[model samples]
Target chain A: MSFVSLRNVTKAFGDNVVLRDVDLQVDEHNVVCLIGASGSGKSTLLRCLNLLEVVDRGEIEVDGQTITNGQVDVNALRRKIGIVFQAYNLFPHMTVIDNVTLAPTKVRRVSKADARDRAKDLLERIGLAEKADEFPDRLSGGQQQRVAIARALAMEPKLMLLDEITSALDPQLVAEVLTLVRELAETGMTMIIATHEMSFAREVANKVCFLDEGVISEEGPPEQIFSAPQQPRTREFLARVLAAGRL
Target chain B: MHEVLQKFFSPHAFRVSLPDVWTGFQLNLKLMVIAEVLVLVLALAIAVVRGLPGRGATPLRALAIVYTDVFRGTPLILVAFLVGFGLPGLNIKGLSTLSNFTYGVIALTLVYTAYVTEVYRAGIESVHPSQRMAARSLGLSYWQAMRYVVIPQAVRRVIPPLLNDFVGLQKDTALVTVIGVAESVQQAQQFSQNNFNFTSYVVAAVFFILLTIPLARFTDHLIRIRERRERAQLT
Candidate 1:
């Protein structure tokens, strides 16, 4: 069985359909990149997978267990899946170390000393050990985004969902955030990333899914999806992306 | 101007009444301390109940809304009268009788809590929704997220406004005098009536001004520091 699977998922907000009968699968350690224009359901899809947005109809199975049921413990389910947003929603009131350690100590019930040690280690790995004592507002956008990633990592989640994590950064800062994602992927962390950065998707994603207007129009190995897409919609989207010099 | 100043600040009148007003001033300080603590605790509780999400909390939210509305709409003097007199009038078992001082504290707490509840709710809402999202995504439950992440930040932003309300509350403690609580204003009234001079009233006003000016300045100091910190973040 696939490590993660969604069967005929559908979601809507009033009359606006954000995901319609979408089916997807991800094996263990697979890096899947979702590529689409704004309002094309990429972010919504990731949100649904994390149960941030409940599906109006469908079944989601993680590690062969059905997690879409209302009876599932959402907080426990969320602990196994970490999600990072575009806005880099670091707790502005907390120092970098506190932001990273809060979940471990509060939610996971780790001892304070152990959580601190693990938070420090994660910050060091992200090249931000010197910033542990500084508040998030004092950090640059790139640094804040990295701290957000470290904060997510402190949970030691099995699957990581990154929703346009670099879209809010300056062009120069985007590369630094993406580099950390690449390192995470290399270390065998399973991730589902929604992105506008096509080249980075091609380089890092094992599979690429192109979504158009609440549906996955085409999906394949990154090479096939980027170089030679099968579907007309995928081709047109890529053409526009290429015309914009983004490919 | 000299004649007017002499009437308001007559040295003989001020000196003669100082001890009487001082005795009442102590009562004012005590009432303020007790009432302020109760207001903080009760206002926060009301705000949190009103803010609770989901269908299960609808009744609680409605109750909180009605409470703030009714209490805040009524003139405080009337509320004080209602609690100080009405409760004793009701003559219910076990609650029919209490010290006038206790009744005075209850009255002030009820009225100020309504105002403070609104202040706290504004502060709680001012915290960006993204902060809650971040906390929940890390597996914290809704109440847990609010307790650790939202309230602390919200409380920080609301400190200056909360202090503003506190100053208002401190001054309002004089209102309890209508219930025969014998605070500074009541003492001033007695002196003015007995001595046929209004200078004692000035002494009472001076006491209030002395109490509030430092708090007002402290609020300004906090605001300046917050503004400076935000500006530092921008550059």
Candidate 2:
């Protein structure tokens, strides 16, 4: 059984069609990298998986439970699937520790003492324990994204979604966040990332998917997709990324 | 100078009866306090109604727009007259018999709730939609997200504006004097009428300025804190 699956998913915003009859699957404990040009619906696809953007038509299952079409309680489904955005959307008024602990304390109804201890441990794991009491404003973009990751992990999600999580960071800050994601991959956390960092995608992902105009144009092992793509579009994309010296 | 002192500064002339001043001050405080509370509660309700989900949202928004436009378009003194005198003549049975104080409270609440509603709406909207999404994605219901996350931030965001509104309420309490509610300003006017001294008028001005200046400074301090936090975020 697939750990996560989307069957015949379709989405649209007004007259603009975003995703059309998209089907995908993620096995447990695998990193799947989705690469696409601008406006290819990669972000929209990730949002649909988390139910942040509901599917107009189709079924989405996580750990074999239906989450789309109002059949499943969205709150319960979302708690099992964590999502990280390109922008580190940390609550500005909250301390880092507070941000990490909020969901567990409020939604999970965990005791304050347990939440605090767990938050501290997660912050330390993300290498920002000393900055726990500081506000998100006080951290660098790289540090802030790490805190956001820690915040998502506090829920102990079964699957995590990364929507170009490094794109919004500064060039200097990008390497640190990618490194963190690489470590998470090594730990066998199931992840689906929509990203432009082709080198990191090639290095860390087991499977590579090239999304073109809201459809998966080609997909294969990273070795085959990066160096020996079969589709002309994928080859052109790789050439541009290689000329830029990234892939 | 001696004549002037005797007329305006003599202990007998300047000495106000403690019981009368105390009674008047308490009534004034009560009026302002109750009016402020009522305005805050009603404004929040109106803002939520206008912002709530559904087809009814448009009509609620239209009603809020009209209420705000009419109240803010006219002066509070006019509202006082309509509530205190004009409405009574309609002899709406039970309503006409309400005390002057009750009429004053009703008028002030109606007038200020409109302004407060706008303040609250701006504050609630100032919080980014992402914060609400973050809360909802964590398994909170929509109302839970609003009550715990959105409202707390909204309250913090609008504190300076809300405090400014409170100062306006403090000064607007004097409008009740038009309805014969004997608050401090009205009591002072009565004293001056009996003795033909302008000192009572001077005292009233001093009292209001003394009360409002500190609040203005405090609001300034709060704005500074907010600005510093914003700057920190950017840098």
RMSD in order of candidates: 1.4, 3.0
- CAPRI category for model 2: medium
Question: Per-residue lDDT for B11 in model 1?
Answer: 92
Please write out the lDDT profile of model 1 over residues B1-235, one tens digit for every residue: 7776667788999999888898998888988899999999999999999999999999999999999999999988998899888888998976668877788889889999999999999999999998898899999999889999999998899999999998998899899888888889999999989978888889989999999999999999999999998898777
Interface RMSD of each: 0.8, 1.4
Q: Whose TM-score is greatest here?
A: 1
Cα lDDT tens digits for candidate 2, B1-235:
9877755555564556334444666677789899999998999988877678768578888888899889978899999999999878888899998999999999999999999998999988988998888787776777778877787889898999999999999889888899889987787777777887655655666667888899999999999998997887676
Question: Using alpha carbons, what is the TM-score of model 1?
Answer: 0.97
**After superposition, candidate 1 runs with Cα above 4 Å error:** B1-7
Please, what are the lDDT tens digits per residue for candidate 1 over residues A166-246?
999999999989999999999999999999999999999999999999998899999999989999989999999999998
Top DockQ: which candidate number?
1
TM-score of chain B of each: 0.96, 0.88
Superposed Cα RMSD, model 2: 3.0
Chain A TM-scores for all candidates read: 0.99, 0.97
Please, what is the TM-score per model? Answer: 0.97, 0.90
Off by over 4 Å in 2: B1-23, B56-74, B81-99
For A1-247, candidate 2 gives per-residue lDDT tens digits of 8898888899999988888888888899999999988799999999888788988998988898888868788888878888887888888778999999988988889999999999999988888999999988889999999998888999999888998898888899999888889999989999999999998889999899999888888998999999899999999988988888866
Residue A33 of model 1 has an lDDT of 97
Displacement of the residue A67 alpha carbon in candidate 1, Å: 1.8
